[model samples]
Target: MPRLFTGLEISAQTGLMLSLLRGGLRGARWIDPENYHITLRFIGDVDDPTADEIADALARIRRDAVEIRVNGLGSFGNGKPHAVWARVEPNRALMELQGEQERILQRLRLPAERRKYIPHVTLARCRSATNQDVARWLSEHGGFQAPAFTAARFVLFSSRSSVGGGPYLVEEAYPLSVAGGLGDDFNADAFAGHDFG
Candidate 1:
């Protein structure tokens, strides 16, 4: 069985931009730039045939590409720390996509997700952090927001571990045609968070 999930591949350019953000955090275990993505659903480990079925189901998804603005910065823990992530601004388009994908996965008979949907891109994993450190980091990086970018397609990815990192790979892409074809990948250099003025 292979680990599987659906995600939006952050283009090479976006990956670079995200990498730069990670550079600021001294304690951050910066995720490899190549593995950066916005995951829609995690399908866990499954057989090849189920993976194919998942791809087929996802290809039937009919929705145009959406505009996603990456904004805000936050960590996900209190007391004993766990992880840190970049949060996305909530909007109808994002909510709809999340709900739609959730429903699709449920129809496939997967277990119901325990938590409510909150869209975000995980940036770093924190083993632990002191109260003072967390406060300082938040204050220094407050108001962190990435410029809006378009999400053109949803992908079914096969994740596996390697020496560099473990369990993240793209297997197939199911595009959502909006206007013409998918929009070009946003340039990281253009949106590089420099000065943030």
Candidate 2:
């Protein structure tokens, strides 16, 4: 069994910028920079056969690369404040990709996602942090932004049973055809050195 998800990996430069926003929030476990990603669909735990089906279905997506912009910061949880994340500017390409994934998963018999999709790159997980703590932290560092980057690929990532945010393995990869010369210089080597932790 594997816990699976499809997501776009953040570039090294963008990861570095997110790393600078790590501290100051007590009880918040900061996600390692290399682990930062914008999830398209979280498929949760799945058996081996199901995982294979997911991979096969995702490989059929023939979409073009999407331009992703990371801007501002916000936290999840209405009153409890469970996580802090970087906002991903909503764009049609992103929504279409995510929507396609949703439909594919549902067609494969997975339960439909109940919550509406909100694009974001989770930066940290908050355990004991309060609403006031999260608010103050947001107030101070909410202006965070990173240069726009083109996502040339989305990955099928798997994680073992553990606290979230980290050590995700790339089980499979799906490339997006580049429009013009947008992703001509992008290469997997830029994301290869880390230990996946």
Candidate 3:
């Protein structure tokens, strides 16, 4: 079995900027810069056959590349702060891509996501941080922004069954094209030389 998700890996430059936002907040377990990503759909633990089906289905997606921008910082929690993240600027292309993924997963008989999709690159996990602590941290780094970058592809990432963030493995990748077709050069192994960190 593998815990899977489809996501856009952050550029190294953007990851570096996000890494700087670490610390100050107590009980914050900062995620490694290499693990920063905007998740499209989280496909929880699945059998190997199901995972293969997911990969094959995802390979058929032909959406164009998306221009991603990291804008502002926010926390997710009802009362006690649970996590801090860098917000992904809203864009039609990004939404369409995620929506398509949602439909595909549901068609495969997977359960729908309970929470509304909010694009964000999680920066830290807050275990015992309070509302006051989160509010103060947000006040200090709320203006955080990163240069816009084009996401040429999305990847299928596998992570260990653990508590917090990654050591994620890029299992496969699918290129995005304006022409709505996979190019002949599309290689699943093309992620080899790239550094997600």
Candidate 4:
């Protein structure tokens, strides 16, 4: 069984920019630059049959390529602060693409997602980092922004189910160039502290 999901791949240049914010904050395990992505939907471990059906359904989406803007920085746990991420500014195209994925998956009988979708590219997982620690870190790096990029494609990725950063594999890719199409990936509840798998 594979742990699968869909996501938008971040450019290496953007990843390098995001990587610069790695240290200083104590107890943060930064994700590798290669794993940097904006997840569109998390499809948990599923039977091969369901996976194929999902691929087929997703490939049918038609929407325009989304213009991604990494505007700022934020943390998930609020006062508790479990994770930190680069915010993906949500717009109509991005929101609709994600919403379409949500509907398609629910139609596949996957349980409806319980959390409101918040678009973000996870930067690090917080471990024992204090409220003050996070606050200070946010103050220092909150102005983080990457050059806006056009997402021409979205992909279905598979990952090993394990703790500690990712080595997520791309299983299927769905291009977002059909005049109109959906995006690639997103997470469970962002505040829920999920990795990019």
Query: How do all models score by TM-score?
Result: 0.83, 0.92, 0.91, 0.88
**Alpha carbon deviation, residue 110, candidate 4 (Å):** 0.1
* Candidate 4 lDDT over residue span 33-57, tens digit each: 8999999888888877788788888
RMSD of each: 8.0, 3.5, 4.5, 6.9
lDDT of 3: 0.87
Task: Give per-residue CA lDDT, model 3, range 1-197, as digits (tens).
Answer: 78899999887788999999999998899999989999999999998888888888888898898889999999998878899999999899999999999999999999999899999999999988889998999999999999988787899998998755999888888787735554333455665532222
User: Candidate 3: how large is its RMSD?
Assistant: 4.5
Best by lDDT: 2
lDDT computed for candidate 1: 0.68
Better of 1 and 4 by lDDT: 4
- The Cα local distance difference test for each model comes to 0.68, 0.88, 0.87, 0.82
What digit string (tens of lDDT, one per residue) describes model 2 on residues 85-195? 999998999999999999999999999999999999999999999998999999999888899989998888988767588799888878887867547547766344222
Off by over 4 Å in 3: 178-197
Task: Order candidates by lDDT, high to low.
Answer: 2, 3, 4, 1
Error of 1 at 71 (Å): 0.8
lDDT of 2: 0.88
lDDT of 4 at 3: 78
